[model samples]
Structure formats: C-alpha cells, structure tokens
Target: MKVKSLFVLTAMIGAIAFHQTALAKERETGRSTGPVVYVIAQDKFYDSIVLADLPAKGRFQQLFPGEGPSGLATEYGPGDVGYLGGRWWVDGNENGEMDEEDAYFLCPLLGPGRDDI
Candidate 1:
C-alpha cells in the first residue's frame, strides 16, 4: 500500500513538472500572441494594419480616411480589419484582391468587436 501511494504521488509530481515545462517552452516560443487589426478607410485599398497585443473589445487605434485617391497608382490607402481561419487577415473584400469593393471585416470570432465580445 505504501509503495502504491508513493508511486502515485511521484507520477503526479512528474506530470505537473512536465506541464509547467511545456508551458514555459510555449511562452518562450511566442506562440499565439495576438491578432493584428487592420484599419481600412472607406476609399483606400492597401489597408492600415496594426499588431494588437490581444483581441480585447473596445480596443481602438486611430485611422485616417483617405484624401480622395492617391496620386501614385501603386500606393494604396487605408483598410479595415478582418479575421478568418482562426487568425486576423486582410483580403479586403475576400475577393483575393484589394479594391473599393474590398471592405473591412469586423473582428469578433476570437477577439474584439463593437460590443460583440
């Protein structure tokens, strides 16, 4: 009986130690830190991206609306944020390209949104 109890206690301790070590490794690896919120302007394309610490509701970042269209054809303006496949993405309209129709994707699946948390 004594040996059985000792073995059980030892196993529990070992399990806990392993779990802690795994967690520490995960932290050091910086896995699943947070999502990047994309702030898109009404007329922009390229999209303004931000790396958020975490997806917290009511969290905000300032955005500037585009001043008409960019004189340079290659330079894109602003864009909204989006989320899919368990990660924040910026496909704009989800149309596989950035265009005026490509709008922002409100985040809420795992992080922040307008009272959607």
Candidate 2:
C-alpha cells in the first residue's frame, strides 16, 4: 500500500511539473492556445477574488525593449501583493534596471480596468 501511494504521489508531481514547464514555454512564446484559457484578476469585488474566461482580443501587455513577448502584473491586489504567475518587470527610462525614477509610472493609473471595460 505504501509503495502504491508513493507511486501515485510521484506521478502527480511529475504531471504538475510538466504542466508548469509547458506553461512557462507558452509564456515565453505567446499566450496559451488551449480552448479554455482562464484568467484570474487580483482585484476583489465585494470581498471575492474574480475569475473569468480570458478574452481573445488584447490579452497581454506589450513589454518594452522588445523582450519577445510579455504581460502586465495582473495578480497584483489592491495592496500590491505578489504571486508566482504574476508579471514583474523593469523597463522604465529605457534602461534595463529598476531605479528610483523608473519605479514610478508617468500617470498615477493607466487606462480602463477589466471590469470597467
């Protein structure tokens, strides 16, 4: 029984690792082409995490300096929390490093949010 349990656990872990590897490759290249691409929005509406089926048009945010392809930090909550699948970058002032001036954005906030649009 113990050996069988260990085998099942190992198989589960291997499957998860393979899924993550495929996802990382997809992120590096382009968005996932699967039929159902789910997206999680960090903003909480009425004390609930929002989840939606990712739209086809305007999916990822364009990365500066042309790093192939990239996306915005969508998992950031109201208080700026971090997560594994969230996007983090440093591309201000056209430099490759995050400095004091490059940390802030020109406008306080960007365009309309997902809920708004």
Candidate 3:
C-alpha cells in the first residue's frame, strides 16, 4: 500500500510539471496584438515604416517632416488590432528605400497589384 501511494503521488507531480512546461512554451510563442504596420516620415522626402507578422501591440504613428504628425498610438480595444500579412510601399528613386519624394501607401495585405499606381 505504501509503495502504491508513493507511485501515485510521483506520477501526479510529474504530470503537473509537464503541464506547466507546456504552458510556458505557449507563453513564449504567444503572438502580440496591434496594427501590422507603423509608418513615420522622417524628412520631407523620407518615411520610416515597420512591418510585423503578428498583430501590433503598439500604435502606428506617421510624422512627415513638413506635414507634421499623423496617426494614433492608442490601442483600439481587443481583437480590433489588424494583423499585416504583407505590405508594399514605394521606394522613392527606385532605391528600395522610402525617400522624401517616394509615395508611401499601404498595399493590400494579401492581393495582386494595385491599379492606382
């Protein structure tokens, strides 16, 4: 009887340890929430844009050197945050960088080409 009780307790403790380990892994891999892209203009001709795979956890602000500040950094409630699957923007001068003269626009997250360009 004593051996049986000890075995049961050990098994219970092992199961609990395994459960906690799994929970930790889930937390480590958990995705954050928020806007997928946060864009900010550095100079009159340059823009800074950041892209993320999961939902954004922070605000997206755009500050055009000449145009001033634009966008809100506040979180819009729970699931309201948008996830960016992909993004496309103009690289002014065709240099693969967003410069002052380049036009910056959010491309469709998952679509084929923009007709307005």
**C-alpha RMSD for every candidate:** 20.2, 18.1, 22.4
Per-candidate TM vs. native?
0.18, 0.20, 0.20
Off by over 4 Å in 2: 1-40, 43-75, 83-90, 101-114
Best by lDDT: 2
Candidate 2 lDDT tens digits, 1-117: 334333433443344344432122333324332211112353321111112222212222212222211112233433333322212222344565543322221111221222311
* Candidate 2, poorest ten consecutive residues by summed lDDT: 104-113
lDDT by residue (tens digit), candidate 1, 1-117: 334333433443344344422111223324332222222232322211222222222322222122123211111122234213222222222355433332222323222221100
> What is the C-alpha RMSD, rounded to one decimal, of candidate 2?
18.1
Model 1: how far residue 17 lies from native, Å: 0.4
Show the lowest summed lDDT stretch of 10 residues, model 1.
67-76
Q: How many backbone clashes does candidate 3 have?
A: 6
Model 3: weakest 10-residue lDDT segment is 39-48
**Which residue pairs show collisions in model 2?**
none
Where in model 1 is the C-alpha error above 4 Å? 21-117
For residues 1-117, write the lDDT of model 3, one tens digit per residue: 334333433443344344422111222324222112222211111111223221222322221211212111111211234423223222223464443433333322211211211
- Report the Cα lDDT for residue 90, model 3: 28
